[model samples]
Target: MATGSPRPAVLRERVAGLMAGTLTLPLGGCRAALLDPQGPVGAAEKTILLNALAIMLAIVVPTILATLGFAWWFRASNTRARYRPQWVYSGRVELVTWSIPILVILFLGGLTWVGSHDLDPARPLKSTQPAVTVEVVSLDWKWLFIYPDQGVASVNQLVVPAGAPLRLKLTSASVMNTFFVPQLGSMIYTMNGMSGQLYLQADKPGVYAGQSSHFSGDGFSGMQFDVRAVPATDFKTWIDRTKAAGPALDEQAYGALSKQSTDVAPYTYRAVSPGLYEDIVQQHLPPAPGPVAAQPASQVAPVKKAS
Candidate 1:
């Protein structure tokens, strides 16, 4: 009775001071970027994800709890246990087991279909400010980001103006890869002969990590970068620094640069060939005959459909 049993000694475990908080939802730094989204598309996607998660957990949580509770209750020692020796399914219970999960699946499928379509990476973000286009080339194990507008380029580091919409035109020179900037947007794939796009914006100024989620071998573990969100004016300074540090990247040089490799450090370039992205988009490599001029209607053969 002495002082309420001398209060249990306060014991604490330090994990770099990042002690986990909450059992259900752990503490996170930029959770707002995901759940408290800044745009309609993000909000919709986040809603669908959350709802789907909750719906699944609705079943999972109860099942796990029931399993544990039933395990203990049905133990041989408990005289209160109602042993079912000749058990048969009840129509009502069966109906519930089937219909409930079916209904939940249908709802989840509907939400996924709608959200995925609406948040299609290729779909343009509806906003007053035009997106800042950045062409991304996935290298051996590095990221090459080209700021076409600013006529600058960099490796492993990308900077964008805060509040400005940004789009990435992504592709890989060799194996496939997934570009994921956790706090900015969802992951999108990059593959040879195919291009993908990801739209994003940073609500506030900060440095966020961007990584290649998919493994691409040797240097896959090191295939990560920094996404620097800064003020518009600061972006200019960044450009100048890039320009001062790196020589111009030309088509011929780019060809050599694009070769497979990984674990590269940040590099920058002051200038690049104009329309380089368009060329790359169309699979046009220098000295490879610009791009096949679009076939004119007259030169194209029109075939009739068979009945």
Candidate 2:
């Protein structure tokens, strides 16, 4: 009787099953969202993180091993090891101490400088495909995502086509907040009367987690959202369904939606009013002068009305 090795397919399946089991372990087994990203931007960020860690560990590992080695070699029972009590300033020791740290610092500084420009939130993504524009307003404890091209909007949920670049225009309707999607990288700030830009893309169909990384108020813990990426065909189908079944997002509706709240359920709208985002930004601005603007409080003369 001849004994044969396991087939390639069976071997692959067994390995995959083992990986799945390990990933689902109870304690901290949930994957690190930043390290295991679903998009290009997130992957780049993860690379930066790993490179920095490796550079530091280059120094750390040897130092730890040398410490253990010294401890064991100079053990009380060991008689052959030489004593270093009289040694104080060796050239080799000085060189190793200064040069290695200096080199690490220089490398880290250069790496940070280059990475800063590459990961700039305002810089547009480099891609051949057309980008989709989404206007985001950070309201009290909730996120509002507006799809300009589709003329639709959603609260606490964002949906886009996988493999297409996303161009985001972000602002705040109330307090300042941060719009962050861990799997897409980049955390951009949103403030009243100011707009920020961010570029991101999902490489495949999946639902990624998004949240307000910055603390806002009591409801900060509930400031979470979902990013759903689907195929282009499915994205279009979603748009059509939203148009047919969802309600319109107009000024009055937005006013109600902007009120302070917590744990707001995700919902979509079929239609969004044009320039609504711009209007929200304008509302935060100081009133502009009229044809006959009021004089400054100090410059104005006191008015004597009939008593």
Model 2: per-residue Cα lDDT over 41-78, one tens digit each: 99999889989998999888988999999999999999
lDDT of each: 0.77, 0.87
Judge candidate 2 against the unseen true structure and give its global Cα lDDT, from 0 to 1.
0.87
TM-score of model 1 vs. true structure: 0.74
Clashing pairs for predicted structure model 2, backbone only: none
lDDT of 1 at 146: 89
Model 1, 228-252: lDDT tens per residue?
8898889878888877766788887
Whole-model alpha-carbon lDDT for candidate 1: 0.77
Deviation of model 2 at 252, angstroms: 1.5
Error of 2 at 113 (Å): 1.7
| Residue 90, candidate 1: C-alpha displacement in angstroms | 1.9
Off by over 4 Å in 1: 1-46, 65-84, 240-245, 286-307
